[model samples]
Target chain A: MEILNRTKKEGDRTLLDDLAQKELSRRKFLRFSGMAGASALVISGVGLTGCVRDDDGSGTDGVNLGSGDIGILNYAYALEQLEAAFYTQVMATPYSGMNALEGEYLKDIRDHEIAHREFFKAALGTSAIQGLDVDFSSINFSSRDSVLATAKAFEDLGVAAYNGAGKLLVSADYLTLAGKIVSVEARHAALIRDLISNGSFADLASLAPLGANTANALDGALNPPQVLAIASTYVRNRIIANNLPTS
Target chain B: MNVHNLLHEIENVDPEVYDRLDSRRKVMKRFSFIGKTLALAAVPSALGSMFNKAYGQTNDDVKDVLLFAYLLENLEAEFYKGVVGTFAAIGVPAGPAQGALTVIRDHEVAHVAFLKTVLNSLGVTPPVYTAASFDFTGGNGSRMGPFAAAASNYGVMLAVAQTFEDTGVRAYKGQAPRLINNNDVLTAALQIHAVEARHASHIRQMRRNLASGSLVPAGVTLQPWITLAQSGIDTGNAGANAAIQMSYAGEEVVSQATVPITNIGGAVISANEASEAFDEPLTKAQVTAIVDPFVV
Candidate 1:
């Protein structure tokens, strides 16, 4: 129900509104029932009906990440594509005053991002979404500050995305695979942070925006919609992740 | 299969079951209007799943994973405690390096406490381990292993710290699959996992800075991320320390999910980049082997 309202607020009124309408009708049916003990049964029946309804025909007109495990995979593939492209551009036009070591490490990062993108692409095979169109006009590639800031943003976002999506995966193998990739992203985030300002790699005070590293010292985790909203800044494609598993 | 009977059975086992199910009363209020329209045959399975959702999460598998995590956090907390306590003796000046070590020590301590609270909430007693319980030298309390100088040398201390942090990342990853049924715990564990990776990266940066005599080095290949199974630390005598090397084992893998990462889509992704792009998991057994040398 919270997600229903969120999607509605985002102006995605097609499939979500239909589902909400169905739920309203179901509630009306329940209200008209005379038997007192059968409300629980009706509620349970509504749940089953909702699960069945989620099987098909709810995708948006955009790049719809399908349902279930494949949807989760495509979601990851899309993020990797964005990151890979960003790094490829960063390497293609190195920022001014970037020292020799910075250039070398940036190239290494570029290659790593490329490797991650290709791995996801090959792993996804026919199910992979098409290459995304990025709008990097806001980023000043010639300026080291701007490029590093954006890199930090993407790395942190990637870590949060994977952390939030791990539980959505039904297969343990996929969860482990995601786990394997996310740590690398975190490592990248730390390096980028340090390159910007020393010893701020895991600084709890500065991590509030990303939403973790509090008193508990845990990293951030962002759900699909929250992540897509942030990622949509640079990605031109309207990534429709409405069908990703909620639980 | 009556809903009331199920509640009664649960109440018999957990006297405060309704309190645990905070919304049970709201759900019960809806019972008055459902009978005429709903089929009787559809009641039990849905209620069963709902109850399972409410209660079936903290099973033995989740407990095992949590317990393993607890042990690892205890180890890390103890190691950092040693480093922070001996920073002055170890040549760590009272500056950014010392400050960073203190921050890491605090985080590890918080992790230990957090895991303890979670385990206790699940009705399990977390085992206690303190600084006395660990030997940072990998000497099993004898303090004579290859890293014996770790307590006195800043570089050795940073190397040992990097190894533990890297191992922590891998250990958390390996146990994630066992926690799949418990989403909150899984997400929490991943949060901790990423923090450990950050710690590793910072330690690597410290080591690189130390080696190059520059806060930001020039023409140095030592990266925050591990490159192709390289320990990036001096393990002594041509890197003969098997205990330290074991932490990096299987990290050179260029294949994921049976797909070779090199030359993918005709991109010239070197094996080094392929391996660096992803960190591999270490099973509980492998992690135990890596940590046993330091545990008494």
Candidate 2:
């Protein structure tokens, strides 16, 4: 009990002093805590004492998206990587009967996804996770219906992932960035839905598979666990996201 | 000495004591734990300070964000109401186009109600406004502006609707940072924000379809996503009606977080693609400047 109290006090003082003197960003502080290890674990109150298994190059246990803002960023990066890869494949092998406009738009989507993926990777810098290997075996790229259906799924999932992850962000700047990206994702979702069926965009009732609520007319928001569960199907590697901040 | 009695006493001094705490049950559980840990005399002061640390301060930033969201929703709800009312006059066919507009109008109304409920829960009496409070013609209620024909022409109505929906998405994105402290509110705002984006995309699709003379066009110059700040709506002769351009102002950003997005990872991303990759946020002042002309 004495050791616990002392550890808690020291952790609190270190955090408060750093906040007062340096005005450190949450991401910086989280990185600092990651280095501090056990002491920082107490500060987070998760009660775990040991190094969090983040990108340790151990493939057996999967990639553990650490905690706090960085974890969320990595989570987002993983999704973007998946999207970029999928769209790249879509463009490389256009679906049958794809007109000039559809071909142009799909290529545009591929470029946008690449841009988003690169943006997250650069923003995360050294903390960014490795490029995820996706499994697109289920998607029939030659079939328009199959490709459009998959695109709609990924777009909706991306929107929900960002929406669910928004509240978990501690930095206002990061929150705003996520906001900027999520709406674009929503726009993509709408466009894809329209491509499948005209006037079906924003029709939440039909998107029950994605957890959309028709009553509220609000888009669905899936937590990290829920998002990862669906993303795992296409994402070959296991993404351990247990440490993402819930509050 | 009883936890309930202590709460009752605190309630007399501060009527919103319960609201400040998580809940009565949680308070009782926490106080019981504290009762066993500390001496009985230390309970009141300890509880007081605990409450102070927990929920003593009200966040005016969050309130301001909510209020702004409510106002935007009201503006959109009114605009949609007008569109729905004059669908036939505006040449909006009685099929998918009209149906899409109606769905968007309902969503705006729902967002307004949701925000109003949230404000009321926070003890704020949200200002009540209706179609009377807005000018859909962008003439500040004069009803004689560039978009005056918006009520009678399908093309004009779709343009104005597209502008409003796109602006709504940006406006909501701008305020998301303010609501970060309140997780539930942030999530709710995001849900609405995405819906606005969906609305914007559909409106853009509608405009493109109308132009191509088909319910679903094979190819559209105006993609669902904003490309290089192009409004896809007319700016009048020689861009005389440039006030509407403010809605797309600063949307051509090709960089994010100081990272040049156009050329990354050895791949050349076009400036237009980079801009369309991520939607930019508008400040409150910027959004107000764009919307003020239409607001009375």
List, residue by residue over A136-231, the lDDT tens digit for candidate 1: 989999999999999999999999999999988766677888998999999999999989988889876676666685888899888899899999
What TM-score, to 2 decimals, does candidate 2 have? 0.80
User: How high is the TM-score of chain B in model 2?
Assistant: 0.77
- Which residues of candidate 2, in runs, are more than 4 Å off? A1-59, A208-211, B1-58, B212-220, B237-240
For B161-256, candidate 1 gives per-residue lDDT tens digits of: 888999999999999987876788999999999999999989988888784322222343668887778786554534335677799999999888
Q: Which stretches of candidate 1 lie over 4 Å from their true place?
A: A1-60, B1-58, B212-220, B237-240
Error of 1 at B47 (Å): 19
Measured with C-alpha atoms, the lDDT of residue B200 in candidate 1 is 95
Please tell me which predicted candidate would have the highest TM-score against the true structure.
2
